[model samples]
Structures are given as structure tokens and as C-alpha cells.
Target chain A: MIEVKKLRKSFDGRTVLHDIDATFYTGKTNLIIGQSGSGKTVLVKSLVGLLRPDKGEILFDGRNLLTMTSQEVKELRKEIGMLFQGSALFDSETVLGNVMFPLTMFTSMSRAEMLDRAMFCIERVNLKGAENKYPSEISGGMQKRVAIARAIALNPKYLFCDEPNSGLDPKTSIVIDELLSDITHEYGITTVINTHDMNSVLGIGENIIFINKGHREWVGDMSQIYTTSNEALNDFVFATRLFQDVRAYVAKHGKI
Target chain B: MILTNSLANFGRYCMFLTRTFSIPDRWSVFGKRTIQEVSKLGIDSIPLVIIISLFIGAVCTIQMQLNVSSPLIPSYSVGLATREIILLEFSNSILCLILAGKVGSNIASEIGTMRVTEQIDALEIMGVNSANYLTLPKIVAFVFFMPVLSVLCMGTAFIGGWCVAAFTDIIPVSRYVYGLQTMFTEWYVWYGLIKSLVFAFLIASISSYCGYYVKGGALQVGKASTDAVVSSSIFILLFDVILTKLLLQ
Candidate 1:
């Protein structure tokens, strides 16, 4: 489990996140959701040590991530895997090679073992036959799969995905989301996903934290989200046409 | 405004330097980047350098034949002049220009694309020292490969001049070899090699830095590429002047 307390951040004197606190439970998809520039990305990045918080303690299973030494941080990183929004696969490497990168850097495994592990991860992501293909030769969805394959290749204890559905079609987005959820349940990894996709929030957000203008607006599950009468949450949920229709339907039936 | 910003920039750079240097494994990362940079900058640049060196030698010889009417200044001096100029300026300075146009642009574009796409961020998240992994190898490769390319450029230019002199009847074959042997200096060759090494470092580092710091998207990458090449070229020329004045004296 990951716990953050009073997390705060600023860029050039402009505060982006303020006194935010949340917990991400293991074996479930913990989502940080907000609109653009709402500090969701910054908060998640801080949690992952990508960005340093001006104030707060991020305890990963009780180890304070903020105060860890560089060596300790590297060790901590080995327990974590990240899937970037843009599917940050190394353009120069083939699918298999990209998947094998983290292993090569951090492991004593032989080349054959590395290849075998990479193949297993690739197949796990349903990218079985595309091992030799470079990232440029593949579609965006395929690239995201490759990124996922690489992220999981290390068998990390913590999985962090930043907008995994960005640039993907609705169908592909659902596939990606389901895959992440399934992986989280299967591996029992503490998974934190930063997303704005309402579909993702409703479909797989078992533990959700909503950020608005850099502050934690609400924290709840999908079941509690629609019932919450918070104005900001209502505004965000109803802003979408599909959710608006759903809200109206519930209202007409007096079920909301 | 300028002064405050400049000071702020300096502080930022110092912070970056401290952060990068604090890591013990950065040397290994540097070694990796050096190899990549060498392959991109040195190996890929062979064709252009060869083609340009040959033409430059030929042109110098032709110009010598046209301008010199004094029999006292031997026709073989054409080859000698080509050798001297190629070693002193053409190979070191001209090749820097070529690299600023070619390799510099490549470094900037690649790094800029990586930055925009968040590949660099991915590296950081993985606890990779992005600067050392990305920049060090290129610097090392430039330091090693630039000198080798300088020698190749000098040799090719001399051959090109020899070819022109022989074909145009400006200098006989035997006299061209004699002039080359007489004019050759270990110090001059070393001086040129040293210059090439400096040029390589400046070009690769500045270009890579530009790309690494790029923001936004495709347009930003393009702008970084342009800026890298322009800055590298200007710095190369400026360094060349300073090194020439110091080393030659």
C-alpha cells in the first residue's frame, strides 16, 4: 500500500498541489482523476518520485520515499513500473529489445533468459507476434501495449500508468483499462493510474481520488461518485454528454 | 530582466550539474551515450566528409594553378598549400560546420523528440541517469571520433589535391610527394586533432542539451534542431579562433 500525507508542490512560486492526502490500496486500481492542469499528473508524478514535493511524506509500505537516498531510490524504482501517456517506447529498439531493457540494466540473467522473460511479458500483453517490430512500424495502440509489456517485464510491485488511454480509440481504451485492472488483481500490485477518462473512472476505479485546482476535492469509489453531492464532482461528472444523460435518466426516475 | 533571468539560469544549471554529478553510476551511463553518439556523429558522417574533402582539395589546387605565375614558387607548392590548409582549417573547422549541419541537428532532433514524447521521463522514472545515459556517450564518441575523422579528412584532401595537380599539370607526381613530405609537421597535425576534439565536444554537448530541454511538440523539436546547429556552428567558429591564436603562438 502507498500512503501520501499533506503532499504539496509548486513551480516557480505558483503552487500546483496543496496539502493533499490519499491512500492507494494493493490489489486494486487506485485512480487520480482530474481535468487538464488540475494537478492530477503532478500529484501522481510526485508519488512516483518523478517530481519532488515541496512538502509531504510519501510512504511506500512505510518507507518514506521523499527522504530516501539516491541508492535507496534506485532500489525503490526497481519495485515500480510506469507506462507513460505517450507510450514512451525506445524508438531505436524492437518490441522485444524494449521489453528487455530494464532486465538488462538491473538483472544478472543471461541473454536467452532475458529473451524468454521478454517473450512471456509480450505474450501476457497479447503482443505475441510483434517482437521484431520497431515502435514506428506499429500503431499507437500497439505501442501502448508494447509499453505495458515493458513495464510489466520487470514484475514490479507497484504499477503507475499516466493516461494509458490517451490517443487510443474507445475500444482500445477499454481493452487497455481492463488489462490494467486484470493485471492489478492478478499480481496484487499497488496500481496508481492518472486519468481523465470517465469511462476508466467508472469501469475500473476501485479507489478514486478527485483533484480540483490542485486540491483533493473528493475521495471515494465509483459507487459513491454518482451519489456524492459535491458541486465540483457534480460539475465534472455532468460536464460529459454521456454522464449528463445518465444523470438526467436517474433524476427522471428519482433514483439519484 | 535579462540579468535576473541569466542568474536564475546559472543557478538552475548549477543545480542540474550537482544533481547529475552526485550519482556514482553516471560514468557508466556516460560510456553508453558516448558509444551511441560516436556511431551517429562519426560513422554516419564519413560519406559527406569524404565527398567534401575531395572537392576542397581539387578546388585549392585549381586555384593555385590559376593564380600563381611565378616560376620561383614551385608548382608543387599547390599540393603543399592544400595539405597545410586542409590540416590547419579545412579538416578541423570545415568538418565542424558539416557536423553542426548534420550530427548536431540529429542530436537535437532525437533528444527533442524524446523530451516531447516523455521517453526521457520514462528513463528518469526507471531511475536511469538520463543526462549521463543520453549525453556522456555522445561526448566520449565525439572526443574519440572527431580526431579520427580529422585525420581522414586531411588524408583525403591531400589525395584530392594530388589528383588535381597531376591531372592539371600544375605539379608533377614526384614533386607533389616531395612537397607533402617537406611540409608535414607533427605539431600541425596534433594541433588540428586537438581542435577537432574541442569542436566535437561543443557540438555534441550543446546540441544534445538543446534537444534535452525542448518543450511542446514537433514544432519545438524543429526549433531546437535549428537552434542546436546554429549555436554549435557559432561556438565551433569562436573556439577555433581562440584555439588557433593560443596554440599557434
Candidate 2:
């Protein structure tokens, strides 16, 4: 489990996060949803030790990440895997090489063993035959899958995905979300995803935290999402065309 | 304002260099980045180096043959002249200019893209020292590869000069070889090698720094790449002059 305590972050005197606290539990997809510029990315980055919080502590299984030495932090990093917004695969390496990178860096596994592990991860992500292809040669959806394969190669204890479905089509986005959710439950890893995709929230958001203007506006599961009384969240959720049509239908039936 | 800022930046850069050197794990990272950067920098730059060195040598020989008219200065002395010029100025300065355009731009753009894409941040979060992991290998590669490339450049230029002299009948083959063997000093080769090492350090450090500090987005990375090549080229020429005066004295 990842626990964030009183996390405060500022940039050049402007506060981006205001004492936000949240817990990302294991074996579930915990979603941090907010509009652009609402500090969702900053909050996730701070939790992962990519950005230093101005005040607060991030405890990964009771060990404070910020207080750890550089060496200790690196050891802890072996347990964490991150999927970047743009799939951030090494352009120079083939898909197989990219997936094998973490294993090569952190483990003394033999070439055959490493290849087996990498191939297994690639097949797990459903990218079986694209091993030799470079990132530029693959489609955007395939690239995201490759990134996921690379992320899970080490079987990390914590998984963080930043806008994992950003550039994909809706169908592909759902597939990616399901893949991540399934992986989370299968591995029982602490999974935290930063996204504003309503489909993701409604589909696999076992636990969701909504941030508005750098403040945690709500924290609950998908069941409580549509019924939340918070006007800002209501405006956000009901602003969707599908939800708006449903609202209009309910209003016409005098059931709103 | 620029002067003060530049001075402060220089101070900060010096501190960064010192801190980088002081780290205990510097050698390990240097070894890794060296192998990576050498294949990317040295092996990739060979064709351009050969083409440029040969053509420049041929041109210099033809020009020298056409311009000089002293009987005391043998017509075949063009080979020796090409050797001296290539070893002293052309290989060290011109090759560095080419690398600033090629390798320097590549290093900056690659690292800058990594910065914007959060790969560097990922590395940092993973407990890896971004500087040691990214920059040190590049520095080691440049330092190790540049001197060897300089030697190759010199050899190619000398051969090109000899071929041109033979074709143009500017000098007899025996006289050209004699002039090359007798005229040039060992110091000149040493001087060029020294200059190549300095040029490599400047190019790699500045280019990597440009990439490392890139902010904003893809646009910022493009800007950093341009800045890296431009700055590295200018510094290479400036340092060439300073080192020439200091060492050739």
C-alpha cells in the first residue's frame, strides 16, 4: 500500500497541491481524476518521488520515501514500475530490448532467462510477435502495450500509470484499462492511475479521488460517483453528452 | 545582465563538474556510457570524417601547388603541408565542428526528449543518478573516441594529399614522403591529440547539459538541441584558439 500524508507542493510561490492526503490500496485500480492543470499529475509524481513535496511524507509500506538515502531509494525503485504518458519506450531499443532493460539493469539473470521473462511479459500484454520491431514501426496502441509489457517485466510491487490511455481510441482505451485492472488484481500490486477519462472511472475505478483546483473534492468508489452532491463534480460528470442525455430523460419523466 | 548571468552559470557549471567528479560511482557510469556513446558517436561519424578529411586534403594540396612559387620550397612539399595543417588545425577544429553538428545535436536532442518524456525522472525515481547514468558515459565516449578519430582524420588527409600530388605532378612521390618525414615535428601530433580531447570534453559536457536542463515540452527539446550544437561549435573554435596559443608556444 502507498500512503500519502499531508502532501503539499508549490512552484515559484504558487501552490499546486494543498496538503492533499490519500491512500492507494493494493489489488485495486485507484484513480486520481481531475481536469488539466488541476494538479493530478503533480500529485502522482510526488507520490512516486519524481517531484519532492514541499511538506509531507510519502510512506510506501511504512517506509518514508523522501527520508531514504539515494541508494535506498534506488533499491525501493526496483519494486515500482511506471507507465509514462507517451509510452516513453527507448526509441533505440526494439520492443524486446525495451522489455528486457529493467531485468538487465537490476538483475543478474542470464541471457536465456532474461529473454524468457521478457517474452512472457510481451505475451502477457498480447504483443507476441512485435518483439523485433522498433517503437517507431508500431502503432500507438501497440506502443502502449509494449510500454505496459516493459513496466510489468520486473513484476513490480507498485504500478503507476500516467494517462495510460491518452492518445488511444475509446475501444483501445477500454482494452488498456481492462488490461491494467486485470494485471492489478492478478498481481495484487498497489496500482495508481492518473487520468480524466470518464470511461476509465466508470469501468474500473474501484477507488477514485477527484481533485479540483488542487484540492481533493471527493473520495469514493464508482457507486458514489454519479450520486455525489458536489456541484463541481456534478458539473464535470454530467457535462458528458451521454450523462446529459440521461439527465434530460430523467427530467422529462419527473424523476431527476 | 547576460555577463553576470553567464558568470554565475559558469560558477554553477564548475561546481557541477566538481560534484560529478567527486562521486564514488563516477567510473562505473562512465564505463557504461562510454561504451554506449562510442558506438553512437565514433562508429557513426566515420563516413563523414573520411569524406571531409580526404576532400579538404585534396583541396589544400591543389591550392598550395597553384599559389606557392619558391624553388627552395619544393612543389612536393604539399604532402607535408597537408599533414601539418590536418594535424594542427583541420582535424581538431574542423572535425569538432562536424561533430558539434552531428554528435552534439544528437546527444542534446536525445537527452532533451528523455527529459520532456519523463524518462529522466523515471531514472531518478528508480534511484539512479541521472547525471552519472546519462552524462558520464557520453563524456567518456567523446574523450576516448575523439583522439582516435583525429588520428584517422590526419591519416586520411595525408593520403588524400599524396594522391592529389601524384596526379597533379606537383611533387615526386619520393620527395613528398621525404618532406612529410623530415618537416613535421612530433609535438604537432601531440598538440592535435590534446586539442581533440579538450574539444570532446566541451562538446559532450555542453550538449549533455543542454539536454539535461530541458523543460516545457517537445518545443523546448528542439530549442535545446539547437542551442547545444551552436554553443558546442562556438566553444570548440574558441578553445582551439586558446589551446593553440598555449600549447603551440
Candidate 3:
């Protein structure tokens, strides 16, 4: 499990994350939802050690991430995997090369073994036939899958994905969500996803935290989001007429 | 205000070069990447370097002839001047300035794009020292290639002078040959090469520093590319005088 304690971050005297605390358990998909510029990216970045918090401790298991020595931090990083928003695969490397990179960098595995491991991850992400293709040669959805394959190449204990569905079609988005959900369970990895896509929230958000104006507005799962009386949650999540109608119908019938 | 900003940039540049030497996780990774960068920044650069060196050599010879029309000094003196200027200054310093615009901007934009695109962050999150991984190989390749390119420039400059003099009725062939061999100190070649080595280090490191820390989007990346070339050119000129004073004086 990953635990954040009173995390606060500011940029040029403007607070972007305000005294936020949350815990993400292992073997579950935890989603952070907020409107653009709502500090969701900042919050996730802080959690991933890309941005240092102004005040707070991020405990991966029990060790404070902010206080760990550089060597210790590097060791801890080996247990973490991140899928970037743009599917940040190296432009120079093929899909198989991309997936094989972390293993080549961090391990003494033989060349044949690395290739096998990489091929396995690529197949797991359903990108088996695209092994030799460059990231640009494939579609955006394929690129995201390649990114996922690369992220899980090292068999990390924690996984983080930033906007995994952006620019993808609805069908591909669902495929990515289901893939993430399957991996979280299969690997028992603590997974954190930052997204504003309502479909993702309803589909794969086992634990959801909503942020508004740099503060946590509500925390719940898909089953609990419909019944939350929080003003911000209602305003944002049910802002659509269709969703509001569904909520009203559910409240009246208690069946959704 | 400008002074403060310049000082701050200088401090950051110094720190960046200093920090790149702290050992990497794997030396083979660095070595293989250095070979790759040599192909990118050095091998591919040869044609342009050759073209520029030849033309500059021709121009230097012509200009020297124009400046010294007096019959007393003899045409051989012009050849000597052309050889010295091409090797000691133009090939090393001016060629570096050109590369500062070409290679320097490329280093900045490529890395800046990687930065904005989150590729560098991806490396860092993998526990890789992105700085050493990205820039050190580039620096190593430039340092190794610059002196060789400078020598090539000098040789081509001499050939250009010979060809131009042969085609034109300007100077006798004997005097030009005499000029090439007369009072030629092998140490001058070493001096010019040393100058190029220093300038290469400046270009690679300064341009990389500009690129690696770039923020924002495409516009900011373009800005970083411009800043890299501009800063690298300025530093190359400054180091020219400083190294000349330190080494040649």
C-alpha cells in the first residue's frame, strides 16, 4: 500500500495541492479525478516523486520517500512503474526494444532471456504482432499498449498511469481500462490512475478520490459515488443531464 | 537584472558540467550510447564541415592576397597568414560557432522535446541518471571529433589555397609551397586542436543544459533551441580568448 500524509505543494506562492492525505491499497485500481488544472496532475506527480512536496511525507509501505537517501530512492524506484500521458516510448526503439529497455538497464539477464521476457509483456498487453514496429508506426491505442508493456517489463510493485485514455477512441479506452484492471489483480500491484473520464470512473475505479480547487472533495468507489451528497462531487460527476437523470432515477428506484 | 540572470545561468551551467561525472549505473550503457552519439553528432556532420572548411579556406587565401598588394612582403607571406588563420582561429573557433548553431540547437530541441514529452522523466523514474545518460555521451563524442574535424579543416584550407592560387595569376606556385613549409611549427597544430577541444566541450554542455531543463510546450522548446545556440556561441568566443591567453600566451 502507498500512503500520503498531509501532502502540500505550492508553485510561485500558489498552492496546487493543499494538505492532502490518502491511502491506496495493494491489488486495486485507485482513480484520481479532477477537472483540468484541478491539481490532479500535480498530486500524482508528487506521489511519483517527480515533484517534491512542500510539506508532507509519502510513505511507500512505511519508508518516507522524501527522506530516503539517493541510493535507497533508486532502489525503491525499481519497484515502481509509470505509463506516461503521451505513451512516452523512445522514438528510436522498436516496441520489443522499448519493452526490453528496463530489463537491459537494470538486470544481468541474457539477451535471449530479455527478448523472451519482453515478448511476454508485449503479448500480455495484446501487442504481440507489433513487436518490430516503431511507436509512430502504430496507432495511438497501440502506442499506449506498448507503453503499458514497457511499464510492466520490470514486474513492478506499484503502477501509475497518467491519462491512459486521452486521444483514444471509446472502444480502445475500455480496452485499456480492462487491461489495467486485469494487471492490478494479476500482479497485486498498487495502481493509481489520474483521469477525468467518467466512463473510467464508473468502470474501473475501485477506489476513487475527487479533487476540486486543490482539495479533496470526496472519496468513494463506483458503488458509493452515486449516493454521495458532497456538493463538488454532485456538481462535477453528475453535471451531465443524462448522468443527473440516471442519479435521479436511481434515487427514486434504488436499483442502479 | 540582466547581470543577475546571466550570473545565475553561469552558476547552473557550472553545476551541470560538474555533476555529469558522478559514476553511472553501467559504463557499457554510456559507452554504447557514446558510439551512437558519435554517429549522430560527428559522422553525419562531416559533409557540412568539409564544405564549409573548403570555402572558408578559399576565402581566407583570397582575402589575404587582397590585403597585401605590396610587392615587398612577397606572396608567400599571404600563404603563411592563410595557413595560420585557418588553423588557429577560423577552423577551430568559427567552425565551432557554426556547429553551435547546428549541433547545439539540435541537442537543445531534441532533449527539450524529450523533456516536454516526458521521455526524460520516464528515464528518471526508472532510476536512471538521465543527465549522464543523455548528455555525457554527447560531450564525449564532440570532444573526440572536434580536433579531427579541425585538422581536416586545416588540410582542406591548405588545398583550397593551392587550388585558388593555381587557377588565378595571383601568386607563383613556388612561393605558395615555400609559404606552406617556411617557419611552420608543429605546435601550432596542437594549439588549434586544443582550442577546438575546449570549444566542443563548451558547446555540448551548454546546449544540453538549455535543453534538459526546458519547460512548457513546443514554443518553449523552440526558445530553448535558440537559447542553446546563442549561449554556446557566446561561450565559445569567450573561451577562445581565455584559452588563447592561458595556453598560447
Candidate 4:
């Protein structure tokens, strides 16, 4: 579990995150949802040590991330895995090579052992025969799956995905979402996803935090999302007629 | 303001080099990458080196023959002058300036594209020292192969001059070979090789630095590549003068 306390970040005196406090539980999918320009990206970047917050305590299972030394940070990063929005696979490496990279860099595994582990990851992501193909040879959905496979190759304690569903079709987005949810539950990894995809929010948003203009507007699970009294989140999440009718039906039937 | 910014950039460049010289996390990976880079940056440049050296060598011979044809000037002076020009300047400094355009821009654009596409971020998130992992092998490969390239450039240039003498009425091949052999201070070759090594390091590191810190998107990457070439060329010329004064004096 990761605990954030009074996280404040600013750039050139313009505050991006204003004294934010949140907890991301282990073995759960923690979704940070907001419109564009919200501080969700900044928050995630700070959590992963990509950006430093001006003032706050980011404790990863009781260890303060800010106070850690450079070496400590590096040691901690080996236990963390991230899936970039663009599925930032090395353009030069094939799928098998990409999955084997972290193992090669971090572990003492022999070549055959690394290959076996990478093959297992590929199989887990359902990309069995595509190991020899380059990232450019695959579709965006496949690339995301490759990224997911690469992310889990090390079986990290924490997993961060930055807009994992962006640029993917609805069907592919659901697949990616379900995969993330399954992985989080299976490995007991503290999985945090930054996304504005409402389908993701309503589908597998086990613990959702809605941010509005650099502030946490609401916090709830899917069960309580429609019954929330937050106007901003309602306007943003249930803006479409389809969602509004669903909200009406949920209100009338008291069901999801 | 401009001076302050320049100072800051220089400081940042120093810091970047410091980070880039760390011990590799895995020696096997380093070995593999260095070999790959030697092929990419060094072996691939052989054709360009041969072509340029040949043309310059032939031009020097022709120009020296035309200008030094007077009775007061010995017949061997054309060969001597061409040899001096190729050995002292063209093979080392000029070649590096040319490569500062080719290899330097290539490194800049490739790394800059990686930066814009978040590949570097991905590497960093995986706890890899992205700077060292990406830039060190290129620097090592270029610096290590520079002496070989210099020797090859010198040999190919002499061959070019030999071709000119054998085919044309500019000068006799025997005289040119004799002039090349005459008063050939082996230290000059060493000096050129040393200078080439420094220039190669400059080209690789400066280009990598330009690319590594690239922000924004495609336009910024294009600008960084241009900046890498221009900056490396300028530094190569500057170092050529400094090294010549220091080494020759």
C-alpha cells in the first residue's frame, strides 16, 4: 500500500497539486480520474519519482520516498513497474527481447532462464506467437499488451499505467482494463492508473479518486459513483445521455 | 542573459557527462552494445571516409602541381605539399568536422526521438541509468575506432594521390612516394590520431547531450539534431587550433 500525505507541487509558483492526501491500497486497482489539465499525471509522476513534489510525504508501505537516497530510489525502482501511454517499447528490440530487458538488467538469471521467464510473461499477456515481431509490426492494442507483458516481466510490487487505454478502441480498452485488474488481484500489486475513460471508471474502478482543477473532488468505488452528490464529477462522468439514463435506472432500481 | 544560459547549459553538460561515465550495471550488455555501436558509428563511416579522402587527396595533388610548377620549385615539392596538407589537416580535423554532421546528427536525432516518445522515461522507470546505457557505448566505440579511421583515411588519401600521379601528368608516382616518405615525422600521425580521438569524443558526447535533454516533440528533435551538428563542428574546429598549438609547440 502507498500512502500520500499533504502532497503539494508547484511549477514557477503555479500550484499543480494542492496539499493532496490519498491512500492507494495493495491488491486493488486505484484509478485517478480527471479531465485534461488536471494534476493526475503530475500526481502519478511524483509517485513514481519522475517528478518531485514541493511538500509532502509519499510513503510506499511506510518507507518515505522523498527522503530516500539516490541509491535507495534506484533500489526501490526495481520493485516498481510502469506502462507508458504510448507503450514505449524499445523500437530496436523484438517482443521477446523487450520482455527480457528488465530481467537482463536487474536479475542474475542466465540467458535461458530469462528467455523462459519472458516467454511465460508473453503467454500471460496472450501474445504467444508474436515474440519475434517488432513493436511496429503489431497493432496498438497488441503493443499495449506487449507493454503489459514487459511491465509484469519482473513481477513488481507496484504497477503504474499512464492512460493505458488512450488511443485504443473500446473493445481493446476493456481487455487492457481487465488485464490490469486481473494482474493487480493476482499479484497483490498496488496498481494505479491515470485515465479519463469513464468505461474504465465504471467497470473496474475498485478505488476511484476524481480530481478537479488540482483538487480531489470525490473518492468512491463504482457502487457509490452514481449516488455521489459531487456536481463536478457528475457533470464530467455522467455527461452523456447513455450514462445519465444508466444513472436514472440505477437510482430507480438501486442496482449497478 | 545569453551568457548565463550558456553557462548553465555548459554546467548541465558537465553533469550529464559525469552521470554517463558510471560503471555499467551489466558488463555483458555493455560489451554487446559497444560492438553494435562500433559497427554503426565506425564501420558504417568507412565508405564516406574513403570517398572524401580520395577527392581531397586528388585535389591537393592537382592544385600543388599547378601552383608549384615553376623552375625554382623542385618537382618533388608538389608531392611534399600534398602530403603535408593531407597529413596535417584534412585527414584529422576536416574529417571530424564532416563526421560531426553525419554521425553527430544521427545520434542526436535517434536519442531525441527516444526522448520525445518516452522511451528514455521507460528506461528510467526500469531503474536503468538511461544516459550511461545509451550514450557510453557510442562514445567508447567512436573514440576507440578513431585511430583506425585516421590510418585508413591516410592510406586511402595516399592511394588517391598515387592514382592521380599514375593516371595524370601532374607528377611522377615515384616522386610522390618519395616525397611522402621524406621527412615524415611519425609524431604528426600520432598527433592527428590523438586529435581525432578527442574530436570523436566531443561529437558523440555533445550530440548525445543535445538529444538526451530534448523536450517537446518532432520540431524540437529536428532542432536538437541541427544544434548537435553545429555545436560539434564549432568545438572540433576550436579544439583543432588548441591541440595544434599545444601538440606542435
Per-prediction tally of clashes? 4, 1, 0, 0
lDDT of 2 by residue, B12-128 (tens): 667656644545343543566578789998888999999999999888877776776577877556666767788889989988998899999899999999988877876665555
Best by TM-score: 4
* Per-residue lDDT of candidate 1, residues B1-249 (tens digit): 999976885576556444444443545435665676677778989999899998998887778667765878886676677678888999999888887889899989999999998999988888777876776677668778988888889888888888876786766788777767775788999899999989988887778778888989999999999999998898899999899999999
Poorly placed runs, candidate 2 (over 4 Å) = B11-36, B71-80
Q: Residue A51 of model 1: what lDDT?
A: 91
Candidate 3 structure quality by residue, lDDT tens digits, B78-149: 888988898678889998999898899989999999999999999989998888889999999989998878
lDDT of 3 by residue, A124-223 (tens): 9999899999988999999999999999999999999999999999999999999999999999999999999888999999999999999988889999
lDDT of 4 by residue, A1-256 (tens): 9999999999999999989889999999999999999999999999999999999999999999999999999999999999998999999999999999999999999899999999999999999999999999999999999999999999999999999999999999999999999999999999999999999999999999999999988899989987789999988888878989987998899987
Task: Give model 2's docking category.
Answer: medium
Give one digit per residue, the lDDT tens place, for model 4 in B73-133: 8888877888888888988999999999999999999999999999999999999999999
DockQ values per model: 0.64, 0.53, 0.83, 0.85
Q: Give me the TM-scores of chain B across the candidates.
A: 0.90, 0.92, 0.96, 0.99
True contacts kept of 1: 0.75
Ranking by TM-score: 4, 3, 1, 2
Error of 3 at A137 (Å): 1.2
Tell me the lDDT of candidate 2.
0.87
- Interface RMSDs of the predictions, in order, are 2.0, 2.6, 0.7, 0.5
